[model samples]
Target: MSMYNEKVIQAFMSPKNVGAMENPDGVGEVGNPRCGDVMKIYLRVRDDRIEDIRFETFGCAAAIATSSTATEMVKGRTIEEALKLTNRDVAEALGGLPPEKIHCSLLAEEGIRAAIEDYRRRRQGLPPLPPRHDAVCHHEIPETGEETRE
Candidate 1:
């Protein structure tokens, strides 16, 4: 049987917010070297809320689905609210992902956080933060059913 659920397939096949934004308020790119999956997220924030969000992912179906769903999940949310979005939430929104593929959801979560941080930094006239490689390596494996640390 296919490991992916209907929701996952639907999202993967018809990913929302799949393109880059022009003059985005913030941008974040993350990758998993282990699997060679890369994802980039763009954000446009207004009044402390995410007015628009988009993503481009070069990865497996799970990665694409998570990226697409993550954009839907964060749009119209306050930056603080977006920060609270979790990998589990992304997975849950897609019904679920295979244990081994759960990391894709983490990528989505980190991408959104990184993008929001970038926006905050730019708004404050600060330089962009360094690229993040820790999102995958340091993150607790979400498939273990462990609660991730912020």
Candidate 2:
């Protein structure tokens, strides 16, 4: 069986908004220490909405696909709307992802939230938020059928 579905392959082959923005209003970067997959998202916000979004990712096919899908999901969406997005939403948008690669989708979700949070902090004249190191494994292991550590 194919490791990736059609939607995931499409996004990986031709990722949308792949480059970093020249002068982004906000930026969020997240990395998985276990897999060494890193994702950085840039946002252009106006009127509390994401007018444009872009991403740069260093990882496997699933990571690239997740970043591409996440950017597309949040573009033109209000901050409130974008904040509601979850890793499951990203995976569903990409048709689905392998159990082992699910963490990639979680990174994408965190990237968007971090960028928006940075934008809000900047607007309020507050310092940038610290890097996020929280675990992203809230899903059950498909192989062992047991809960994994965070």
Candidate 3:
């Protein structure tokens, strides 16, 4: 077997919080089909702080390790603190990721932010996050195959 960084191998081999929560206050799932990586995060919060976090992932070793590390980093942290977590942090915590697998760290970052957002919206009685305007596909034609501007 090829040698791997001890930290990365440790994280991948013995991931922390590596299960689903029974009743999570917030859940976030993100997948990158391009790379065949998917991550699902579950969190339980109290007093606007994360009390518990868990994750299930279907991806490469780096992806799994990132998700596992992210779960441990966020628990017991306030929403604000958790949001401050960056992809760099997770990668660094894991002793760094290979260039080819960097996107896995990004997915980990997105998963954490997404989970935090879900928890905030639920706690504040707010609605789901608004979709970005650019994400909308307006197929309606205005006149003679011309697209209409919203």
Better of 2 and 3 by lDDT: 2
Worst 10 residues of 3 by lDDT: 141-150
TM-score for every candidate vs. truth?
A: 0.87, 0.86, 0.79
- Model 1 alpha-carbon miss at residue 4, Å: 0.6
Model 2, residue 30: C-alpha shift (Å)? 0.7
TM-score of model number 1:
0.87
Better of 1 and 3 by TM-score: 1
Q: What is the model-wide C-alpha lDDT for candidate 1? A: 0.84
Off by over 4 Å in 1: 133-143, 146-150
Residue 125 CA displacement from its true place in model 3, Å = 3.4
Task: List model 2 lDDT by residue over 1-150, tens digit each.
Answer: 328888899999999999989988888988755556878899999998999999999888988999999999999999999999998889888877877788788889989999999888988999876666556633334565322222
Candidate 1 lDDT tens digits, 1-150: 337888899999999998989999999988765666778899998999999999989888988999999999999999999999998899888877777677789899989988988998999999986666544453334545543321
Ranking by lDDT: 1, 2, 3
Q: Candidate 2 deviates by what RMSD?
A: 4.3
